[model samples]
Target: MRRQPSMLYLRPFMPLIVGLSLGFTLCLVCLPLLEEGCTSEGSVDQVARLRKPNSVQETQDNPKPAKSGGKQPFRARYISTELGIREKLVVGVITSRETLDTVAVALNKTLAHYIHKLLYFTGTRNVKAPGGMYVVTHGDDRPVWEIAQTIRYINDHFHKDYDWTYLVTDNTYVQGERVTDIFDHISMNRDVYMGKRVPFRDMDGYYCKVGITEKDGTQAFSQACILPLCRGEDVCLFVCLFVTMETILDLQPDEWLGRCLHDVMGISCVGEAEGVDYHTYEFSSTTDPDNEDSQEFQKAHTVHPVVEPTDLYRLHRRFAHIELDLLYPPIQTLNPCFPAQIKNLSHKTPEGEAGLTWPIGINPPFKPQSRFDVLSWDYFTETHLYTCPDGAPKCELQGVDRQDVDDIITTSVQRLNDKYQKQGLTFEHVRLLNGYRRFDPTRGMEYELDLLVGETGPDNIRDVVTKRVKLLRPLSQVEIIPMPYVTETTRLYVILPVTVHDREQVAKFLDSYAQVVLDIHENSALTVVFIYDPLDAQNIQEEDVFGMLKSMITYYERKYPNAKIPWISIKTDVPTQLKIMDIISKKHPVDALFLLVTVTDELTIEFLNRCRMNTIAGWQAFFPIHFAQYSPELIYDTKPYPATVEFGKEFGHFDVHAFDEACFYNSDYMSTRTELQKQRKENEDVSETYNLYEMFLKHSNLHVFRAVEPDLRQRYMPRTCNPHLSEDLYHSCLVSQAEGLASKEQLAKLIFEHDNEIKSQAENVVKS
Candidate 1:
């Protein structure tokens, strides 16, 4: 029985024995090969042999002893030999169908050079993948949620470890080398986020409801309170990271990310922190072209709101180099190249050319050099002396040659029509008339033209005409009157309260007032209604003051014949003043009224021009002028004053305040003046002058505009002093003008100094 079982039953064990025998034989045969360092295919030895040498391999078997007090060698693994910090960065750009192509071009031009791995997540698969671009399709179109989902998807699908993940919008432009440098000291394992930060409370009130429920069962922010907190999409993505992944973000308050993070999440960003340098730029839409050359721009790691392709290209060209120190030197040490000053010289007769000269024995006429000088003339002139040939009283022609005057008028009308057309304005009809003041025989018989334009609405056509007319006839002047058949021009009737002290103390201001008339004449169809207050007429007799003022008006009228001048005398009595204003308003249906309490203060040409432009563009019903008041000592200083010397400091350092001299009353507001006066009379405790503007502001909706530019300190001077005309009025007026001029001179000097410094620096840099 044992013999019969051995032959056939041992078949399974025989195969196992053969396999063991074969393995034993193979090991014996490979022993010699293993000793010789020969490795077989698909073996662990083969894999080890194929791998490149370690970057920090020991040259000898034994380690070298360290010198006493010497620093220890870093044992950290090198991820890449060529790309240090860049090797760890993985940038993910969030874009949509609308901006996918634009973002692709921008990334390909800028960040694509240094990024270890670049991914673009878009809403749809409508885009064709570019040559080296990794595009991922997402179901969501919203950038806020999509950014979060994209990061999560990358982390899940991609098994490779990435030290940093940068999430940015399509408009974000990154300087890759700058970014690497910024994050060089930062640990890769830390949950670091970098971007601009904004406060939640500073955002618009509508986004105050968005918030998360804390673990304590109370909502961090209720639904109703999210509106004011919620920020723009540019900011929301940064906040999403903290919600989705417990990320510690380094927020820059100056950047879009910080603005969004703080605005939406009530998070305060640090100006400086570990692992982050706040060097991001949220470039303003109105950024000056010169800002691109600034050190801040050179050092910027990321610049946001850069949607334009040209801007992306420019940034790329600027930051492509590796010379960080040379490119981004400290601004304090670097001298900026100042722009060359272009001197605007007045027109002059060419050398050896015959010019017009005053005829012998012909008086040049009485020209008032000072406000105190009274010209012997009348405000109202005879109509027959300057009437048009067509018998229209409003039309006047002044020239020795009638045909030549007619030809000039015709040319001016045509030119005006063309000018209006070029400015995108259309006129229903235009009529030209000739004007004659006292003619200068030597100046080829002086003449002027008046244009009557009919349009559908109020427009800045008058401004255009005034500018062009001056070019056409530098010796003459042109007036533009918007007719009733055209759109109604809003008339600003200015009421100036002039005291006798004002006449003596602020004579320079009176001279400056003539400029206001010129501004109104050139820019708008308006009138000035000066109301002289005789109560404080102590410096000069009331009659003499009135006569002097009349003379001044007559002088300006003759000089600017097209200008309309209407004025009346009023007692200091408020009731009497109100009656006179009412009468004036009835006679001329004014669209607005201004009460100039500070009669010495002059309305600048810039302010008047702005008012005209705003009105033409579409003015509000109740518009107020925001003005400033400057100190007399500061204004009149002959020595250069520092820019740091705060303006309007004497008036509580406020740029705007309750200044009656700065108030403007619209048509609706002018109607309420009677009620305001009544209220003032009933409540004697209220200041009549101060309460007038305040009452209108409180009762009605106001649309205010800053009439004066803060940079122009001369414009801030009030026409009259606080207590009528103060004793220091003249000193202040003169000093302020001198200070303005001195400031300009000082600025020029500073520019020259800086230019010299820049030249020296350039020479040093070259020598080095």
Candidate 2:
């Protein structure tokens, strides 16, 4: 004969025996009442009791229904009023050594308020924990066995009492009110299963979702267990797993329960396609705290894999805004008679301060980590790590065009002339050094203008003066008097070419440039311009480039609000070197220092200051030879990616011949380059085509200073090495792994020693 299922033992004449005993006892009492001429009300009560027991009578805690002649309407047991949903729901929390504290936090703050018949299951013996938590198990660590025993215990003790039962791991967070609301319309008679559903390994069935644990850069994707919803008796039917345990030992508990209930009892998951199973939010170590008041969080019934005890309490406080009448407190509290000590913990006290919701004995008092912290942290670390001063206000620089600051510059320059009218130092022209508009929370939009005022002497010679002023715009449409401060500062304009192919590299450079400018004192001025060819944007749409720039601008503005790092973008037919220089000359004054570079080049504050101090307007120019990195194919030849270069050797040697890639020149010298370009464009048939290095050599009248800039480095191409080269020099041809260079003192000393030799040689000749 086929073996009967283990669940069949639950119904072995127990129902029949209980029914016969209740009927016999009621009849004996009713006969005595009839002989005593019982009133019509008493007789009606006797007949009502004699009828088949109603749903209310099934649970001892639920109140009796009103007297009625017809049958009562079908009501889901989960929808309760007398004992409320708190008593109707039973939660069995599965815990282990790893999750005891987290489980305690959940029970203390959240689950204890919504579940009365709560049970804790830990299969291990001799575990020290708070009393009335550890359920006795047969010393089996398997989740399948734990789940079976929990269901069997619920069926035997709380059979037909609670309408719903939930079995979840300690890391899972249950929003009790949300679960009740989801099943408010479901009938108690129907068997229901709920959780995040995913395909079981190679099996046709689906099981509740599990999470992965990532530790020390390693990942372990373990299967977790969750059994939710369904009545006590209905869930007990899953204990039949003992009969087929051998064939299904590999299955997770949730998967095993899903298969058994579906295959044996013909019950399919009535969990709605978009219900709790779909709305659960699973968090890991790196997840942000989702807002509880949002509509998405309100719909989610549970949050899983909340392994930290403090995080569990934080989530509880978020959802604790709702005040549900706790008609039935849990049968077991973490501490005995704990409720009497506090009376009742709710959102408000009788005297009405904040919620007296602090849990006892939990370490590190709750501090709110609001969304602003996250937003600001992300802004600072968007591309690189940055440290913000303590108690700094959140601020961002709003991008503005020339027209927006034209009036501010005009007004500020006029104010300066009025202040110095008697001294005969007249301010002639106002050039925008780095004027920017910023939005202040307390005040409306205010303007900070860093204007370069051109002061003309009596001899008609011109010199630049820098004046910084802050102006307040009020609601009365009145202009406030500007406060001015003057300082002698170097002004630099950086130019670079960007394309769709170099978007990522340009983004990294932009971030690094933002950091570089942070080291600049308030007196210095910096602006950057990126030129791109509209026709050459091949890989991505032109709009994508605009979007990337827009986001990066917003991020940097928020992080370094006071630092004047202005940026501009131009679209041209071709971003040629001569064309870019011409654009700069037209927009900026002749004295504005210009440094042309590529996206792969690294920059520093010292290098920028060197360009400013070394390059004299019209008298001298700086042509820095940059250090280049090695080729990946040469160093990691035939090896896999991330291969290391030769030990103790950094990549690349300084190329003394490379001067065209990075150059610092004034607009007067740029005019000569423009003339060369114009001549080339006109005379195409010329045999001798002069390149940039040749142009530098031809302009011998200007003292063109050349030196190796140790701080500046550039990337090398793939074929930078040759196989015929000696093996001793092979290390220089491999990809660079240089995170940092030699100390600043060391590099500065090396550059000074080399530069003095060149300076002495240049003095002997008419150098350019």
Q: Write the per-residue lDDT of candidate 1 for residues 1-768, one digit (tens) a residue.
A: 788778678877998999999999999998987864533333443355458476756568754443333234465476463344334656777666776666556766567767777787876766766555688888775434454466556555542445555565667677777665655666644323344433344354221111111100000111122233332443465555555332323222123333443455544443344745656665666754323676777667666666576677666655653354365445324643311111111124342213222332233434566986543221112222434445454443244444454555565555655556645654432444334433333232333445555543245443223222321222422324232221223444555555554555334554565665564454333333444454434434634556666677677678777776666655553322344445555654454544333443445655544444444221232233333444434344465544333454342122233233433444544556655656555655333243334445554444444343443233344333234322343344344444333344455666887899999999999999
Candidate 2 residue-wise lDDT, 1-768, digit = tens = 334565576578878989999999999989976865534454466576789566544567765655534444466655653344334466777776555645554554567656666677667776656533544444666766666676667655665456666666777777767666655554555555555566656556655554543110000011111233233324444454455756555556666666655554544333363333336766666655534455666556677777677677667656663332132234333565774556454324564424343333222223347855322211221122122233354333233333345556666777787668767778965566554454443334466666777997666678988888766543332334322222225666776655445566766676667667654443444455655566544534645455666577667767777764566666664344454555566776766767777777777777777777767665567778777665544434375644222222345556554443544456655766755556665755211233344565564455677888777776543223333333423333332223223334545666897799898888877563
TM-score of candidate 1 to 2 decimals: 0.26
Computed on alpha carbons, the lDDT of every model, listed in order, comes to 0.48, 0.55
Identify the leading candidate in terms of TM-score: 2
Model 2 — which ten-residue stretch has the worst lDDT? Answer: 215-224
Give the CA lDDT, 0 to 100, for residue 366 in model 2: 31
- Runs with alpha carbons beyond 4 Å of true place in candidate 1: 1-491, 505-521, 525-543, 573-584, 590-598, 612-655, 662-666, 674-690, 701-768
Best lDDT among the predictions, by candidate number: 2
